[model samples]
Target: MNEKTEELRDIFTNVTDGEETVTESQTATRGSLEKDERTIDERLENVIAQMRERYAFETTLTDEELIRVAKGFYDDVSDEDLASELEVSSEDVFDARLSLHLVESEADAPDIDLAAIRERDAADLDALADEFDASEPQIRRARRVAAAQDESRAANDRYRDEFDSILGDSELTERIASDVREDGLEDATEGMETDVSL
Candidate 1:
């Protein structure tokens, strides 16, 4: 592993106490997009617990709620829905999400002055809405997005790094490119076979 690859490999060390599987596709077929000894929810819960201890957070929500925040974020569940489900206020849900480092949705709209909106999170929402020609809810969402970006920057996104590593498989990709160039067979898919197979 080079410097960057090594840094990614150094992340969270695949559970110090976990099972290892190196099954062959021909021998055993597993169905997850990526096989893991721990399920996603289990891993999310563990990560939340670790974050709580590491950051010395004093959140009142239980372990279940923290896991929900992590899963809910990706599931596209709004803060209002999450708050309703947890029987907590939206602010409490947002705080819990940030506390778990579940923040990282950023707005990149050219029309909105996101920086100004973020800077004045506590400023009058009505004035900001008028200045930006956006609704109060829109400004509020922008503020939340800004907060998520700011908070998520504290650490590298682990799953994204994993995806990058897989997508950047130079060995396999280089071999495929070399074979294609060596064969001098342009348009490999131009007139490929489309017959039935068992």
Candidate 2:
């Protein structure tokens, strides 16, 4: 076993009082994206629980203290709320505060707009349909599908662009370059098949 695995096993051993022996398989999978391994979040939560016993007596902890505590409890509790309750500064709460705020606020807020959005006029919709020159139902369905496709394409393109940079090595050049040069070939073929099917 590597030093890190040994260290982790040691730490795990120190934390757990139960007669759980650290297996080689367990150490091998630690910090890996394997299904069997405990997630960093789960391991951290366990560690935090062990650590929290030391601070549990404090009625309130400061933002720094809250952050220190929360660093081991990522995505577990509301860091901001804990920070506030602990009398910690907003800046001291971790970098995930923004994401947490967005998520929490979104959850608490109404799903649909409380205020009504103005509906598109019949004439406007008709004009849009006419502009497309397809059957009204077909045009509406196609528009929705096209919008979704555009979003999917954009995401795929972004991932591919990032992948291209990493895959520019000489050994992978031919395959990646050919793939890029013939990009959208499958989609084009699928479109032809779809037209025939329809």
lDDT, each prediction: 0.63, 0.41
Best lDDT among the predictions, by candidate number:
1
- Candidate 1, 92-150: lDDT as tens digits: 77777666655544522335676787778566899988998888877776776566555
Query: Which residue pairs show backbone clashes in model 2?
Result: 63-88
Candidate 2 lDDT by residue in tens digits, 1-198: 999998988788778764467455544432222332554345434433443453232224433453344442333556566567656654344322321111222222223221111133434546655654545554443333333334335445442232223222322555565786688677667646464543
For all predicted structures, in order, the TM-scores are: 0.48, 0.19
Lowest summed lDDT window (length 10), candidate 1: 159-168
lDDT of 1 at 198: 75
Model 2 has how many clashing residue pairs?
Answer: 1
Error of 2 at 83 (Å): 1.9
List the candidate 2 regions with Cα displacement exceeding 4 Å: 1-76, 89-96, 99-108, 111-198
Query: Model 1 residue 46 lDDT?
Result: 63
Q: Could you tell me the TM-score of candidate 1?
A: 0.48
**Model 2, poorest ten-residue lDDT window?**
109-118
Task: Please give the clash total of every predicted structure, in order.
Answer: 0, 1
